[model samples]
Target: MGFCSYKSFVILFCLIFTPLTKADLLSATLNYHQGSYSEAKREFLQLAHLGNADAIYNVAVMYLHGQGVEKNKAQAFAWFSLAADFGLLDARDTAMLIAEQTDNKQPLDDAYNALLKQLSFQWYDQQLRPELNASPALHLSPERRYTVEPKYPEHAYKNGIEGWVWLEFDIDKSGAVTDITLIDSYPEKTFDKAIINAVRRWQYQGNNQTLPYYNRSLLYHFTTYKGKQYEQSFKSQQREYNEKISDLIDAAEQGNALVQYYIANWLSSNDYNATRLLKYHWQQANANGELLLRSAVNGYANSQYRIGANMLRGKYGKVDREKGLNWILLAAQSGFASAQYRLGRELLNSQYVDYAPNKALKWLRAAAEQGLFSAKRDIALLLFDLKKPMQQVSTALNEALAGDNEHPQLLLLKAKIHAATGNSNDARKLSNSALKEAQTRNWDQSSIRHFIATLP
Candidate 1:
């Protein structure tokens, strides 16, 4: 081998023998910005080895600029290719730009392919698997032993589509993932299914002595060319609307159910000054209610449910239970899960409606079958109240708990079931867990404390 520079020797020595420290990306980037190029390159390489895409891209930049090591276009192209494989759109674009500009593309292409092979799953299994297997703590919170990245949708890839998805999930006592809810997504529904499916296969460290965790959130980005074009398009549309709120109003007035629902939902929100239209209508009495009613009449299921729910709570004008029930029934008939859940709750508890246990159960089951965790929990509570068989009640509770193991109401219900079954130790444990959760949430803890005191 040819003689290497002192910096290269140091990097090689550290990689072969030195134990890597947990240096974050921010610190490494700061070092680079502060002109500590050698230090930054070393740190970036360490992070890149652990499959950090940003660090890999930064390393490529350093190689391209000769910040730490001698400038080598081949090495920079290889690093950029590795980052691109890890879903860094900028790195993909940079690599392509370099390939196009270089007179001799064959060498760069070969280097890129070779780098991809080295970074593939086969390489991960050969090099990283043993280290991961030896580290038990990697399975704990804020760290994962293994993760499968969401696949880029084939259609999106071909069309260069890009966006993000925010997800909330739960990890059960068995360390199995559950309750994967899509909190929000840009370009709605595009990457939701892919992200949810990938997250479903994740595992965490389980401790039976502790309650299962809940509401863990993650945001995933799917990008090509860093999504600038799409973002610019979105901003342009916003600017158009900002300049002409009258267009939106005209659309809503033209019996466009979606536009009416959007305006109604925005008006009902507390952020009245967020948009030109909302600000313009802020002083109008019952503007949201009127628009919501129009949207409902125009056959928008979400608007029907929202208006009905608001009416039931006297948010529109008065508690028109009859009208609210009818609207909610229409939404439920259209197969909206939230409407079914709400209608079930109202049928069971609303004083305006005669208590209809059978009807309530039907709606609740309908929602539960659609994977609504709240509906499942309600069904469990209803079954327990009806003095149903312990096995049936337990099954419902288990299903709900699978989705939301940390829900205080579900914990308390489980505690009561344990007490009734003469499992006092289990009852005490669950009651205490419920009490802690209630306290953390600033909920009324008096009832939970009283229940715990009654436990043996």
Candidate 2:
């Protein structure tokens, strides 16, 4: 009679608790076997909610492994305890094992509190699936490529622009853009044409169909940098020139060191309040560079080199060669080509290092390998200085001239080499040609002229 009662209770327990569909249970089983613990946990949790005995066991396994849940021996015991409550034999065995390992009559004291938190958060989890639906691009074809274009008007916008345009487009099955329209980028007819012209050329691939049909809406924003709706025609030139100053001024005023650096560089060449602006921008860039160095410590090689070089040049500041050299070395090691060249030139000119020639040669060679044309020319010049006999110099010069024979620096070097070796005719020919090319390109011509004058 006792055996019969136990057997009947076992059958009743299985019937009441095992509500999981075969597909869901099978997915959980496959995931568990495949070592996809997080995925298995999700599937098992779903079945556990449906009162599946097997799923409850699997969820305990997930807790044991801390897969998508906190690793809590107590929580694992609690889950096993729940299954055991219904007279599950396997659950009874596992729960006893967990209890022994935890050394407790009940699961740990914190397990109940954590379980309460999980129950309270259940509604929050339920609301997440719909929110996920809004971002279906995650499940769409990964093979598809989307080209992004910023929604800037192709033509500049002027002030007094009104009206909203709507752009509706579809991504096709082939992942190409179609049915694109100008969606309220402008108000006036002229401005609208600019937006429409840009839209017609834009392409995209759609997700829902085998080929995209127009079904989506996109927004574009165009901001006016300058020009009021009724700016007189005479003020157009002023607007075009002064508009360049707006962002530069804002960045400078806001103490953005990077922008300040660029503004300083620009003002150094241009004479409009050039000295004052140059000093102010350089000071800000220096302060910003110092702050950045503390965090990155030799990072931002360009910033280090720029600030260092400015200090070296003593432009509106005291010169500090030691600090400049240290920063320059950092920049050179980090592969800033300009810094590499400058460091090589400086160290070589100082001639204090034991292997100064080899060091300069190595740095120049590195910069040249990166396809920096000036660095290539520098290497050729170094080879000319090092190689014995006129033929070797000629070979190096020819190699340097291969890609850019018309470059002023190489031509000047060639002229010098030819003149040094008494090839007056070749020297005169090369120098005269270089002078003309330099003048046309608006490059500095004084050095080329000097070489030509020395030819005789």
Candidate 3:
């Protein structure tokens, strides 16, 4: 049979064996089994773009065995690493195995890191699904059999850069750490690799009686010992700031709103006061809040917004909804885009306030006019909810999508617009594409699927 005919036959067989949504995957698998390596590779690549973990792993295998592509272990490693990140255990094991076998693993590591960075844009494209409360938290803490301290990166040390990295990993049944993820970091990415490398070599005590622990969190702080000479330099800098601070305090006392705001910020900063300054000259309990209040009283819009936001969240003390809203309104009235957006969101969501959709739309529009993509997205959503004209909704969505086309929620909204406009095929295709993107991020797709099902 001709190649196209054979491909059709394989697809037909796949339809019999799998759901229509997964026919493409089964078809690709059949093609691979039939020794049509090139065809299988092509199909897998297409599916992989939609974030299919199985297709991603199959692509890595084909690259590893030189079935359809040239034998490139580095490429295979990159693909396997990506597949592992997509939650494939086999891919994770294969990636680690390849790393162990490779002489001079730097190139493979580089390939993997590079691929991750290249694909990092998709990380923020979808909102994560809320996990069900299925499993209880681990009661017993695992004992460490071996621990390795991460070495400070020479470049970072020389530059006097200090930061901390937070990581989350799982301890497998064999007591080896696996699926290590960098949760967050200060001076981001600088200490990420150092922490990840160290954690991978750590060994934990395995027990037959207990299940392996998952989502173990660890934070590593990288501090530099700046030596006596550096300490002297730091003291000198502190002396200089001390000399200048008295004049600033005088200005702040004289009702210089900007100076008051500046002093408030410096006083509030833990980093500035603890590590870099002689706090004796300026320290006062709740002084930052006092100064911020003074500045806001003197009509500093930024100070008003900061105090309002802090009050709303109870960052300094107790939450005061009425006072916080008043302060935020003052800032928004002064045309602060961020304050405008915040007020709009709070109004729309009835967060510490009554729902006022019209008022929310007004502030959102003001913020959107100042070029905030998030504000534009909110404006589109508000307009849609208000059952405004389709043209206005489309215009707002188009503007927002221009800023971030990969946003799954916006894409799904666009699909809804298409469905409303009597474009069922386009609606289905766009919805499916959005669903695939959301799946790649492991987001909940039940609502999206329901919407798709309702469409013609």
Candidate 4:
């Protein structure tokens, strides 16, 4: 009863005509729902090139939500306008709505203006994610018990060599790294030994249930500023400025408090064109501090946390131990999720003040309740760290895994907790699940199985 089954009817007599692009639209929608936004965006763009209204509208939605690409309302509005020109009623409605919401006066307006010509805009949300530190850490890595920073190789550091290393490794039952195979190393062995060696020296408390296999993708930059080691990505100012970085600088220069917060972090990076007469690493660290202080003074909670973390991590020369704690306290008191986790972790690790494990657990619980993805796993780690009752560790492990059943690190952590609690059967079951996930995800784990077999 149909050319391409029941789906054919929905395209016909619809606001937009889909001659051959019907399948593409459906595929793009499926990809979007499946969290394959980048692929979905590409599919939509192909349809948009052929003047498909639904595809154009979906592209606008992606831009509006910052799903695949960076969020840009002007770009979303412009795409919607194009769809409106093609007689899409929904796109017309959305274009009109967003047009009223934004005025094209600012500098970021240029992209929108280039698309439509003369679209004015106003400023929008300017806060950067905490840029004070290096670009966000591994989006997914196990909670650290002891992390050994990769030693800066003097040979590479002197030459300003910077590159990344993709590493695959397995932790044994005793939490010692066993097999470390270099998946790939950029610039050919420039920084592999440093990363591999440091990773080997790294320590984790491996319990009976913890998955023995683990994986990581690590980046190393051998950079120096005024003869001091700088391990961050923002090495020099002359590197190609992505649109987002450019926009941050533009807004920060214009005195945007949120942008200033980001600029402060960017300034501290050694990656920002040190070839210039005025090097940024040591010179800009103070400037970065000032900008953070500016945003912190305005009560931006993240700025408060970033400054505190930088202080604790030792930016500049001296560390004001008390001041750093106070900054963390202010952010935690303001109910920031990241700060709560940090404060909790700090308390758990503190050698001074009687090592308040209960207080640390409370702070970690607060952070986890606020939906920080890592906090739940952190709490599980903490319970094991505290060497609590087996029942308590089991309960915490269940709570952590309940929120993220397939998170590779959480699954392994659950196994570890079971092993530590002397639940061999439970430990083995969870370890098997972890191995299954790691294999399905294409993670190499040849060394791990042997270690798991050796567990108590």
Residue-wise lDDT of candidate 2 within 27-79, one digit each (tens)? 56767788877777776675454334556667777777787788878887777
Off by over 4 Å in 4: 1-256, 266-285, 385-392, 406-409, 412-423, 432-456
Q: Write model 4 residue lDDT over 217-287, tens digit each, in one string.
A: 23344344533343343434224323334444444443344545544544545553322212322255357
- The C-alpha RMSD of each candidate to the native structure, in angstroms, is 24.8, 26.7, 30.2, 18.7
lDDT of 1 by residue, 1-456 (tens): 221122110111111122213344555776899999888888777556545567788989998999988998988998998888767899989989888889998889788778776574345333322221121222224335458888988887666555567576666555556556664564568889999889877766645433255546565766554234445644545554343455556555544556565566555444222233355744565566666665564456776676565555455444557766777887798787878877887788644546798899999999999998868988999999999999999999999999878877789999999999999999999989997876664444665778888886
lDDT of 3: 0.67
Please give, for residues 1-456, the per-residue lDDT of candidate 3 as tens digits. 322132110111111222222224556776899999999899777656544566778889998999989988998999998888877888889999999999989889888788776553254123111111122233445778999999989887766666667566666555767556554565558889998888888878857543366546565666664434366755655554444454555555644556565556555544432223324645666666777766665556676777666555555444555566777887788787767877887787553447798998999899889887768877887788789999999999999888778666688899999999999999998999888976764444666888998997
| lDDT values for all models | 0.67, 0.51, 0.67, 0.58
Better of 2 and 4 by lDDT: 4
- Measured against the true structure, the TM-scores of the candidates, in listed sequence, are 0.46, 0.37, 0.50, 0.40
Global local distance difference test of model 2:
0.51
What alpha-carbon RMSD in Å does predicted model 3 have with respect to the real structure? 30.2
- Give the lowest summed-lDDT range of ten residues in model 3: 7-16
Residue 431 error, candidate 4, Å: 3.2
Q: Flag the better candidate by TM-score, 2 or 4.
A: 4
Q: In what order do the candidates fall by TM-score, top score first?
A: 3, 1, 4, 2
Total clashes for model 3: 0
Candidate 4 lDDT score at position 356: 81
